[model samples]
Target: MRASESDTWLAKMISPQSEDESEDDILYNDRKFSWSAGYPHWEIFGGGTRVVATDALTSSSLFSLTEAVAEIIKREKVTHAVLIQPVIDILMKEQIAIKLKKIVILGTVGFRSVLDCVGKICDELVNMYGMVEFGTIAAGSYRVNDVNTYKHKVLSVKPLPGVELKVTDDNGHLVPVGDRGLIQVRSQKRFTGYLNHASRWVDQLVRTGWLNSSDGGYITTDGFMVIEGRINGLMDVFGLKVYPFQVENAIKGMKAISNAVVIPIREKETKFCVPCAAVVYHPGSENTTQNIQEYIREEFAFTKENPIMASVYVPQVVVKFKTFPQTSNGKPDRHGIAAEVKRQIDPKKYECIE
Candidate 1:
C-alpha cells in the first residue's frame, strides 16, 4: 500500500473511535494501526471532537501511548476507545482508570492480561461513569485474524504491545504443567535479526505448534496458564527449582519489606551454592538485620522447596534508594536488581548462618 494510503488505513485503525461503530471492527483497525500502541497518544480523526491521551486529554495522534490515554480521560467526551494491551490510562499522574464510552482489550500471556492489569481501570470507570456499559477481553489478535474474512494463517499474530522477542532457551521440551520455561513467539512483524544473524523465521508447526514463549507458566487445573517470571530467573538449589515470584510473594506481604529479589550466590568455603535474598525495606523503617533473617527463615517453611533451610541467611539486606528498576511495562527488573546486589555485597564477608 502507498504511504499515504497506509497512513489513512492506520489512522482509522487506531482512532479513538465512536460509539456508533461496531466494537469488533474498531479493535481490528486499531491493531493494524500499531500493535503496541506506539508512542503514547494518537489522534482519532483529522478534525474529530475527541482525542486519545496516555497522560491526559489532548488532540494529537503523534504522541506516546501514555499521553493518548491521558487525553482521552481529560476530554471525557470520548464514548468509546479500543485500549490495546499494555496501554494504560493515567489520572492525576497515577493510572486510575481507562475512560471511554466503551473499552475493549486484547489479551496475551503474562500478568498484563486484559482482566488482571485492567481491573483498576475498570473500577475507575465504574466510579466515574456509573459502570461500564460494555466491555470485553479476548485472546484473539485483532490484527492477524481478518475477522471479516476469517482466514487461518501461520505467523500472522500481532507483535506484543512493546517488548523484544528472543529465544530464551533451546535445549528442552516444554515443561510439565506447573513448571516454568522459556517464552518464544514467532511473528513476521518482529524487527530484523541480530547483527550476526541473517533474517530468519520460525515455523511453529514444524518444531512446536506455538512459539516457545520464553516466559515460564503452568497450566492451572482451571485451564488458564499462569505466567511465572522468565527462564533466566529460575534458580536450582540442591536440585529444587526456585521461582523468584514464589519467594517474593511469600515475603511481599511483610510490613517491613518493600520488595525482595532472590539470588544464587556461590560459597567459597564449601565450593557449593544456595539462594540468597536481598530485600528492600520500607523507607524510614529501622530494618534490623536479625529480624529480616528470621522473616526469610519463617516464610520459606510454607514453600515447596524451603530454600531457607538449605541456604545461608543474607547478613545485610541491600536497601535501594528508591523503587526497583522497571521494564517499560512496570514489571520489576529482577535481572537488573540481581546485578546491583552483586555489586553491593562484599565478597570477603560472604558468610551464611543457618
Candidate 2:
C-alpha cells in the first residue's frame, strides 16, 4: 500500500539462510530505522489502525507508524485492530494488560507473534453472532484450549451448527472430558479448499478425525483445555518434561540474571543430563558468576530433580552492547545461541542429548 510496505513484504520473502550469502546493502536500507530489536534499520507496514510502539521494543521506523495508528485509535475509538509487534518484544502481553478493546496480531514465522490476552470479549461476540448460521474454519487443537481459557477472545469465523468437534493428545489418544489432544472439526461450512495448493491441509487432518497441532497439551481434568509448548520445543530430559519458557519465566524474575537458556549439555563426569544456562546480566550491574549461582538457588529455585537436575552455574556472563541476535520473525534465536555456546564452552564438559 505504501513504499515502506514493500520493505515488510521483502523481509517476509527473504530467507534467513540467504542473508549470510548475500551482500548487506542488498538486504536492508541505508536509512536508519529502529524496526528491529537490533541493527540500524527495520521496515514497518501500517494502514488505518491504532498502534503503540515503545522505544524498548525494537530499532525501527515502526514507532513513527505505530504512533500514527495510536492517535487514530484514540481519536476514533476503534474496536478491532491488527498490529505486528517487534520480534522479541511481547507487545501483545504488554497491550492485552492495558486498555484496548481488541487487537489482532499479524507476523511471519520467525516473528512468531502471539495474542496473550483474549478474555471477556469473545463471549459477547459469540452471543451476538452464534445464532446466525456460519461456516467452519480449521484450527489447531491448542485453539480449543486457548479459546476455552480466554472465553471472550473472539474469532471472525464460527463453525456452522452441527459441526463435530474432536480433541485429542499428542499420542493420538482420544481424550475424555478434561483431557486434551489435537482438535479437528467436521462441518459443511469448511472451506472448499486451499488456493494454489492442494496437499497442505491434507497433512494436518487424519483418518481418525484428529488434526496434528504440533503444539502439545491436554484438556483439563475439569473439562478445560491447556496448551503446553510446541512439540519441536519438547526437551526430553531423562524422560521428564522441561519447557524452556517455564525456565525462562522463572529466570526472568531473578535479580541479576536477566536472561538465561537451559540448554542440555553432556556432563563430563557421570555422562548424565545437565543444563547449562548462558546468561545475560542486567545492564550497569556488577554480576559475578558466584552471585548469579546464589540468585538461582535462592530466588528461582528449579533444580536437581528427577528427569532433570538444575546444576545452575554461570560459567561466564558476556556483556553485550545490545540485545542478542534474533530470528527474522523477531523471536530470540535459541539455535544461534546454542551455536555460540559451543564456541564459548567445551561441549564435552556439559551434558548433550538429542
Candidate 3:
C-alpha cells in the first residue's frame, strides 16, 4: 500500500474520524489520540531514530507475526521497541536475534519469565499502564543498576505526574492499603467525554470527580499500584468470588504451561458460573487436561478448616489450544476464547472439584 493510504487505514483502525464532529470536538479528540499513542515517549525515541510498526500489516499466525517483527528489527537496525507482553513472550521463546537498547511494555502486565528474558537483552525495560479514555496513567522503568531487583518490582507501577490513583470498595469507600478494590483515577489530561456519549461519561465519573477505572487492584504501603484484573471479569462461584487472572496466573506458574486465559462458563441447570481454563502448553510438553487440573488443585489446595476456598479458585474444566485467537491489535481475544470453549467442551461432563 502507498504511504498515505496505509497511514489512513491505520488511522481508521485506531479511531475513525467523523465528518459530523465539530471543530472543537475534533481538536480535543486529536490531542487525546496523540497522548494514547505514546506522545510522552517521543523524547526517548528522538534524535533521527527510524521507527517501524511492530504489528503485522497482514493477517498471520502468532509465529508468523513474531518472525515478521524480528525481520523488521534486523533489517531496520532498530535499537528500541515498545511491545505488549504477549509479543515479548513469543520473541523470547523463539530466541530471535534482534538486539535492542530499550523496550517499553504495554497492553498487559509482563510475566516474570518474559521480563527476565528481556532484561538480559535490553538495557532498559519500562512498564506502562493506561486506558484509551485516559492516557498514560502510570509508568516506571526497571532499575538498570541491579538486574536481580527487577523481578520484585514487576507489578509495582508509579502514577505519572499530575495523575492520582485510589482503590475504592463497592460502596465507594476507600479501601485499606494492600486490600483489593476498584481502581479509580483523577487526572487533568483525561478526555472530557465520549463523542455523543455524554451520559456514558457522566455515569463513569463520580461526584468527587474520580473516573471509575473498572479495574480491580490494590495499592502498596509505599504508594505503588498493582492491577489484578478487570472488576467486571470476576466470576461468581456459588457465593464466593473468583478472579480469572488469579486462576490463570496459578496455571501459568506451571513449567509446562506457556499461556492461559481463565473464563467463566455458566452451568446449564443451575445457571451458576464456574471457571474454565484455556491453556497453551509449551512445545514438547506432554501435559494433559487432567494433569493441568491436578496441578491447579494442588496449587490452591486448602486444609480441613478452609477446604471450601479451594473449590472457588480451582478451574473445573481445562481445554488446550495450539494458539489463541487475536484481535486486530494482536492481543488475545478473550470473548472469542470463551465462545470457542463453550462450543467445544460440554459443561455437564466435568464435575467441580470440592
Cα lDDT tens digits for candidate 2, 83-185? 5433113323224222355544322211111323344321111111110111223222213245445431112222335555456655555778544345444
Stretches of candidate 3 above 4 Å error? 1-56, 143-147, 150-154, 198-206, 268-271, 297-301, 347-354
- Most TM-score-accurate candidate: 3
- In order of appearance, the predictions have TM-scores of 0.46, 0.46, 0.77
User: After superposition, which runs of candidate 2 have C-alpha atoms over 4 Å from their true positions?
Assistant: 1-99, 104-167, 175-206, 221-223, 239-261, 277-324, 346-348, 351-354
Q: What local lDDT score does residue 141 receive in model 1, on the 0 to 100 scale?
A: 30
In terms of lDDT, the poorest run of 10 residues in model 3 is 1-10
Candidate 3 residue pairs in clash (backbone atoms < 3 Å): none
- RMSD values for the candidates in order, in angstroms, are 13.1, 11.5, 7.3
lDDT of 2: 0.40
Comparison by lDDT, 1 against 3, better one: 3
Off by more than 4 A, model 1: 1-121, 124-206, 236-241, 253-259, 278-321, 326-336, 351-354
Q: What's the lDDT of the predicted structure labeled candidate 1?
A: 0.40
- Model 3 TM-score relative to the real fold: 0.77
Candidate models: Cα lDDT each: 0.40, 0.40, 0.65
User: On residues 37-127, what C-alpha lDDT tens digit does candidate 3 reach at each position?
Assistant: 3332332234323223332134455567667777878899888887766566667766776678888877665555555654555777887
